[model samples]
Target: MKEKLYTLIIICFTMLLTASCGADHYMKKGEKYLALGEYYDAAAEFKTAYNKTSPKDKDKRGERAKKLAGCYDRINSTQKAIAAYRNTIRYNKADIETHLSFARVLMKNGSYKEAAKEFQLVLDSLPDNELAKTGLLSAQTAQAEKEAGSRYIVKKMDVFNSRRADYSPMLFGDEYDQLYFTSTRNEAEGDELSGITGTKAGDIFVSQKDDKGKWGKPEAIVSGLNTEFDEGACCFTPDQSQMYLTQCTTDPNYPRYATIVTSNRSDAAWGKASALEITRDTLSSYAHPAVSPDGQWLYFTSDMPGGKGGYDIWRVRLTSNGLGGVENLGEPVNTPGNEMFPTFRPNGDLYFSSDGHKGLGGLDIYIAKVDKRTKKFVLEHPGYPLNSYGDDFGMTFEGPHNRGYFSSNRGDGRGWDHIYSFEKPEVIQTVKGWVYEMDGYELPDALVYMIGSDGTNLKLNVKGDGSFTQVISPNVDYMMLATCKGFLNHKEELRVKPVTESEEYVLQFPLASIRVPVLIDNIFYDFDKYSLRPESTKALDELIKLLNENPNVTIELSAHCDYKGSAEYNKTLSQKRAEAVVNYLIEHGIAKDRLSPVGYGKEKPKTIRKKLTEKYPWLKEGDVLTEEFIKKLDKDKQEICNQLNRRTEFIVLRITYGMFDENGNLKNPPKAKEQDNGGSEDDGFVIEM
Candidate 1:
């Protein structure tokens, strides 16, 4: 019996050894496939190994997870890649590589906040990881900036051509017209040798919109400028008389060079191309030329030996004679990653494409507005949607249109690029003016609203500029209203009908000081705290400025609350809040005797709730207020009746002098005090309670 048992154990041991050997063999094969960039096949092998291996083998599980994550990333399964990396981390908590990999996938998925957390974890685990540290800092900065309301809204133009690889958009002089780019669906001028398999040879194509507002079919400019080799990344001078295009020599013998070639517009057609004698070398390649609006400067990308990375944008003076010496754009603009496709707008804004900069993926288009006086550029990313986790390049603006054109291989499209025209928002007659008390100082954060003749109400917050502009449909009359807490609202009727194509209409507002019987809204305070919240300070400051401007205007500070607590207690709380505002004004150098505090607790209901019996004469008493009834009421009325109706307000008691000029026209008043409260003429109004 003992011999028989021993035989069974030996057979079992042999079977176990065979299974282990098979799993190890498949894992090694999977690694080899992964190294060869055969990710699909690698995934299959890895799956086989994973299925055969025991879960107890932590080291093997970690290796399998890493391989699977790599394969998933290659296949563009970002969620799955993230999951695999997380699994690897779970199996081996100390793996900084897995954490970094996870963070990258998170960033690609737009989970920046979470990605930043993972990056931070990697830094904590491996302090010496320079790449991870840089990525973490970038992620953190982006997350913070986004939270701070610094965001770019990109609208994708639906216009596309299914047959072509349209890309590299360049704007011209006209606001609605653009020139953009492609290398597919068009024939080459000379020999049509395909650079990449299955597509026609690259050639620069031009499409124009006629006066009738219709985009004509794109046609390859038949000028001798286009060669059999790749030709693209074209930019036109402001006058549209000259063009700079990238000319690449694909012949293997001269495979390493691309030159910027220029052509003149003669007899309404581009002439023969002449290569600029800038950099002449066998090893260097130059492409993607961008000419400034004034035609005084030209920027192009090159992979020359002295570059900081794969390709860097180099600029040269386009003098009266010809092209001059080249200079690198340097540092923040050029990184260790590939940067190309530089273009400049009429406003001297530099727009370019970069893959080296930390971005969603592929190449992202970045803008650097040139400070002409300082001779410096400030680099910034064109935020999401305008940019995606795909190649977005060649942005062009037509004139100063809010809407422009750019090229992208994003959204629901074939894997090729397409030219899209961005619609610059209609040029509305922006009524840019400031709000001020009878005093000459500007009012900041004043809530400004424009009620159009068509009853369209558009609201805008007055910026520190003390100015507000809201884009509205032009050729209409608008009633502009400005309001701030503790100040009487001001109104002006403007008939802004722009007869020209574009114009600016300015309207100034001089608000009357709140004296006797004025209502103040939006007096917010902290939860369970009598102290004013930061937002409340904004409203209260406005009141202080109004008082300081009109020193003779005495006011009464009032507080109110909805029916929530005992009426007596609510009244006391409200009165305290009102007194707090009065004290704040007094502390800010306003006469303490100029303000009076009062409280109204559930006594004045803004929204009168009609009992069901009153609405339907036969209804019974004691019926509760239904949600439908509440919603039927105006939002402001409902808010004024909610339980959270805690507020502070001001009412002008007396104005020593009436606010208007002798002709009844509003006159700018003088400053009451010269105290420097760190308050500028542009400081917005503040009311805190």
Candidate 2:
């Protein structure tokens, strides 16, 4: 009986040891996940450890609670984080980071007074703690802002969002009627839950706006892009002919790293996807692909080596020769925090979200505009209602306006991002233009100069059928000039009406040939006095604009006289008239070297073979107008012939202005300038198992 009793005691002791060891295993696993930034799993494991801790071991229980609170905070569960932190403080009240973290959660939950007290407690111990000081200030500011009411009315997009997470929206189609986004809903193709989010692997989903202007239910994006593996986060080429999507494949032996893949769109359906050859590293994650507006660069977020930290934005050139080496966007853009979901406005400005930058809290959306002087990005936060103490990102503009849809986890404690529509209520406008030769052929290499009455100047170079687009502000007057080698400069002007509605204007620039003598019409001298007529101001101004537009071109401005004038006298008078025009141009901004005056003095006769001959059948080609010829015509016809013979014209003297190299490429394309605000840094993937 004694032997049996001893054996039973031994069995009970073995069972107790097993339970204790299991708790230790949970604690260790939780620590590993916390280090990996997998807060969801870490919280689960830490909660188990907390429940397993002996009631007498208050220190061990407090440690477990503290770790659980951190995980909750990282995952955006403010209430749960607050509860866990309170439990931790009940035992360990002097932990500085814990107190600061508790204050942060309180601030996020809108408990400003409570948060300030907690932050003060930390400051008492660590008086120089910047995070604590900042937390206190942020909490006070948030409380005040909340009371003042928000200008933006943020409502969750119910029709497009699910109980699960949906984010990274991209607008496509010319009308922007199709919206593509990433989701981890239960209906996703993958059956397994992700270790990161504890949800089904992400899949691409699309929502369409109906004719009634209402968003319909979102459906899984077709085109076989979503397989049994994880696939999400996509961007389309400007033409919408192709897509680059992020895909994460699973392996039992390793952590999944996201890779970017391309798929062609044919007849409104997507073709099979093929992985892009961005890098050979299998361990680094590449996601959040954004194609540059010019279609020459593919930008993505990666956790590769050489990154500032976490995930950094990198871009690779997509050339005809294939993908070029990756470049990292360094410094202010990337910190020791994750920067993702980069998108561009129709203009060249870049918008992205980052947690590294100082903000209210979490990830805040920022606009990065190129600084002209520094040749770097100047970052700006939109402030207040457009941002919150939540993960706000994945912004997409509807055309060129300040209103659009974005993803955010504002009110949800579960960190479930949902689509939200935002509007700035300000008027926005855009201008698009096409440059073509006089013969109707597209000028692919045309240079376009853009200037706004509001002190905006930019140069745009076209590639395809000479076309360019620009964003404009409301109530501004804009002028654009298009020029190409062997083609006369063409000018266009537009005034954007100041209205609350968004507007787009299409302008056409039909450039004439410089190789052919292009006439400067309506350029009449004042009664042979060699002074320009008041009626000629429009034509002369256009000439000045052309000279300014084509900085590299030198033009010989030739003046001609009617055959009735004395040959020697007319030559001297025409020379004076040509020189007058050149002087006027110099007084305005044209360089003197670019303009040269010459006198033709009836040396070049008018050729009226086609259009003029069709109107006046009596006129013939290569006809030189003289006193005898004018006398043969009627009074009306005689005056018309004389007027046609006496005009100003310009022909190409040299097409190789300093504007282009010997190979015909632009030598001085528009340099990066800052209007106001705003690497191939890649990483090697490490197996994080």
Candidate 3:
């Protein structure tokens, strides 16, 4: 029995030695593959070593799990990575970055609440970790936004997608009919799979929209653009005559570096591509090139020395002399994380993707608008449908509108990118205007009171430049009044008809001042009578239209006279003249409550302010007209001064337009104006002034 026990012990010792040897061999092999960035083979070997090795050594087991998780993450095996991260934490609970990584993968898997829990765990230990805090906020925000639903209509473009990764869509070609993108499908031109992604290297693919506006099957671009390595992420000049793309050239003994390349289209085929020649730094990577709308700047993503993060968006002047100095986009645009895929709208808004900045999760698209006042970039994330928990980047606009195609890995659990067509619902029709002095500069303190027939009543203040933009619903008629404290209110009428496309209407309010008595040009009364002449119909009709446009306003129609008539007689004549004008307005659909006739019989005469005095150098400011003043002037000048006094003017009395309450609700919601006609009469109204 003693001899049998000894033999059994020797056999058990040999078996343990064999198991230890096998685990060590696999572990070293996995480490070698990991160093080569071959994540697939590295993961397989790591898994074998992990299963064979004893868990008695907690430190080694935890390290192995961590390496396996990293390998899974690089290979796009998110679930396996998450499981491995969890196992690592179970053994080494103090690993803060592992917790953060675990949370990110959880968020990417659409388990936002779970990810938030993990992120909170990291914050519990570090307390002031910005990355962990950002991750927590991102997870919580993503949960809320996803539950709130989406404002955009997003559809996965299956016709342009493949089972493998397909992304970075660009709309180009003569009619914008051809859609070009990067794909890692099995048929890619590359014979070797990428060690970094563990898939076939990226290649350019194009899909053409047929005459019926339907996308056809995608095919490799192949026209000297694709190589055996990686090529994709392209942008074109506004004219689509040139293409700037990213190409990764793999060297056998050296690491692959992403570089920008340029290709020209000739007779519908792309010419030979040439290196973009940014720098000779072998350690740096450059990609994602975009051209400015004016073609004066070339913007691209790079990891050069001066970058604020691992990767940043940079721009260089594209001049006749050659590429100018490189400028980093900096700060809010670039964080301590990667920022890629920079593009532009026709209006010069910069859109890019960043993982360093606070986002929903992973990579999120953000827009940076140059604040005209601060001269700095203001970042904004167009929320919800455009962004998801998964990586969302590589955006391209269809023309200038918000409707376009972007790349996202949202529903794909394997982190495979696919193209999605997104369209914002018909935006509210916008009406913008600027208010200024009639013959002078902008009135910065101007207030724009808007009253829409569709129950829209709001007060908007002008920007520093006296400009105001307000949104209005479709098929609504809006009446806006631009008023200043010392100026007569200006009225504008707009009727927005429902259309399939978004519309922007611009209106200008050139307001006259109350400091001087503005003449009502083209108003002719009968000889020595209050009755309006036939020629005065045009002026009275315009006054009626103004009243209708400013439905909530009340105006005092003041009738004046020249210095010729006696004071008492002129008073009675002017009173009758003002009354007749009010009666005509009431007859032409002007509410009686909106009209107040005042007779300023020669009592109030015209005065020339600094502006008028400059034009009429013979006159000076604070000079009021009387018989003595008019007689002192020349014949031509006397006629001008007298004509200025013999005028009818409507002074804005109240601009509140009883239509709205202080809270913006319509006081007496009138019917949706007769076809958004600014509460006025129909198109065919005969004005008998």
Candidate 4:
């Protein structure tokens, strides 16, 4: 609660007051409270000083106005900030930063065009300034962002909200039905208001769902947890046994610095709280603790030294005995601007709030996903509604689901943070596999063994029609193998890509039969020609890969023809076309000994299978496409039968071809031998498109 509004406001107050010691009594007292980061006390005292200052004293009046504006901005008093900054700019336009500061307030007030003009004015002098550039971009974006909506549907959760601030919601338990948050309502244990916020110090509160999933009334914890000091922003361990929260203790003489505290949770109630000593850097502030999903690291925000700027997210290796090395999550996670309130999804995707990156104003939430290649976190702005000109932070997800709760101050004119529930209706990631026999149909008895680099090993059984759907984590590489008796295992590898919307990855497992020939679809040839078509490259490449996967197997590559062609003509054309496929394979890397070319012209007919029958309802299962059967059909049906008969296929000649030699010993495991190409790439004649 007490952060930028406090820590930053105090520094501004200290720099502004160089006036005489004999200045008004109100001014002197206000300066004292301001230096101590007491925002509420400082604002009250400064108002008295401002009213009493004479209009004739432009020099002194402008200084007081600037001081008041800085405080108002921190306290999130939009109208007050605007009025005060306008007054100060009227007298102190000499300060370009003042214009930039005023423009930011205009942005928060939704005066985008006005904000753009102010930013352009700042840029008129400091053309290359980063802040001014960002301000102009944000102003333009806010205008468009107004009409843009993301997939997320957010609803204000007023069930546990109070007139005062209720923020930092935490979801726990098996069903994520238990809700915990922090509030500064009158119901808080403290009788006195905080000097920083002018409200009762925040205390941890809880709300639970009934059998019907409706949340009951929320109650503040009055036991050993709540004290006169402010406490909020809590996260639980992976097991939900221990809670880490942020607490701010008051010292009348020293500036308030936030620290992280831990509390043990028993059957129902939380027990005594203790300070979690992250480091001995007492001069710095440590707050907003978020434990990593694997429970190996503790992530938090700090103004501690070695940070990129205002506040940066940092973490320490969590160990049984004590904390290990600490490191700041450097840019792009950390920027020259503030980044705080780090949280995580069950899949380990990092979520944090920041004003540092390009976003829709104050502390927009961003997701950081590790790149599979570089393995470094990259930022993604989730877009508007989930973000606004007002501050939005503190996100809590309900397990792996895209639905969850976060805290925002978007609609609250007083800038009081409240809880809101958010759900991404269709942002799911899954892998669907169709396990079946190659050139045949679905293998209902097949089972797939899924293996992942993340140590995921699962036995996924295919459905009655040989399909299996499994939820997959983003950025994981999975290897799946379909297994069934009398069939060679068909393996598929997939690396799921990360996206902001729902995505389904489809894979086909056509397990080759141990006895029958497997037809390679999509391999076509020109009319009455032997050369392979360019469109046939993909299917040919897949066949090459299949042969390499089942290395020991040697296959007979054959081509067939319909009864219309003379036997002599069909045999010669089919043999040459079959050799074209063999030469292409050999030229690409397959050995000649592993492939045998044959032309079964009009001799072998086609047999309709379940999949083919489904596609052609007129064709019955087990029906044979013989010459007489096709002669009796309609022209269209007869053509379909001829196309089915004219095909390319491969049959396994031996599974142990290279397994043993004549001496019954492993043939010194032959290295892949490069085959000779009948023609060179430069030797081919170019074909016009």
Q: Ten-residue segment with the worst summed lDDT in candidate 2?
A: 680-689
Among all windows of 10 consecutive residues in model 4, the one with the lowest summed lDDT is 680-689
lDDT score at residue 527, model 2, on the 0-100 scale: 80
Model 2 quality (TM-score): 0.64
Prediction 3 TM-score vs. true: 0.62
Q: Clashes per prediction? A: 20, 20, 1, 0
Model 4 CA lDDT for position 236 = 92
Segments in model 4 whose C-alpha atoms lie over 4 Å from true places: 1-23, 427-450, 453-689
lDDT of 4 by residue, 1-689 (tens): 68878988888566445333334677888888888888878877777787777666687778878888877888877788889898887776338878988887787787888989998999999998777788899888886875786888889998989999999999977567889899999988878998788899999999989999999899888668888899999999875778999999998888879999999988667887999899998989999999997677999999999998889999998888878889999978998778999999867799999876767777789999998889799888888788888888889987567889999988778878999999887678888889888867788788788888777766665655688777797888888877787787777889988899978789999898988878989999999999999999999999888887778888999999999879999988889989999999999999899999998888889888777887899999889899999999999999999999999998888888788889998875645544466321221211111
| Residue-wise C-alpha lDDT for candidate 3, range 1-689, written one tens digit per residue | 99999999999889877877898899998887777667887898899988877777677678889989989876667889988998898888437878888887787787888999998999999998776787788877876776676678888988988889999999875346888999999989958777667789999988999999988999998677788888999999755678999998765455567889999988879887998787667678899999987577899999989998679999987866778778898888987678999998755799999876767777888999998778899999877778887789888876546778999988777879999999877554677798988656789888777787766656665755677666577777777878788876678888888867777789999776655444567888887899988898897886676566557667788899988879999999999999998999899998898888889889988766666777788888789988799999889999999887888987767767686888998786545434553232332321111
**376, model 4: CA deviation in Å?**
1.6
* lDDT by residue for model 1 (538-656), tens: 76776776676566677778887766678898787777888888887888888887888887765543332233245544323533333444456677645533642454656678765
Please give each candidate's TM-score: 0.46, 0.64, 0.62, 0.62
Clashes of 2: 20
The alpha-carbon lDDT assigned to residue 584 of candidate 2 equals 86
Clashes of 3: 1
The whole-model lDDT of each prediction reads 0.67, 0.79, 0.81, 0.84
What C-alpha RMSD separates each model from the true structure?
25.2, 12.1, 18.4, 17.5
Identify the leading candidate in terms of lDDT: 4
Error of 2 at 542 (Å): 17
Better of 2 and 3 by lDDT: 3
- Tell me the spans in candidate 2 whose CA falls farther than 4 Å from its real position: 1-18, 25-42, 91-103, 114-133, 148-153, 272-285, 296-299, 302-338, 372-376, 432-469, 473-491, 495-504, 508-689
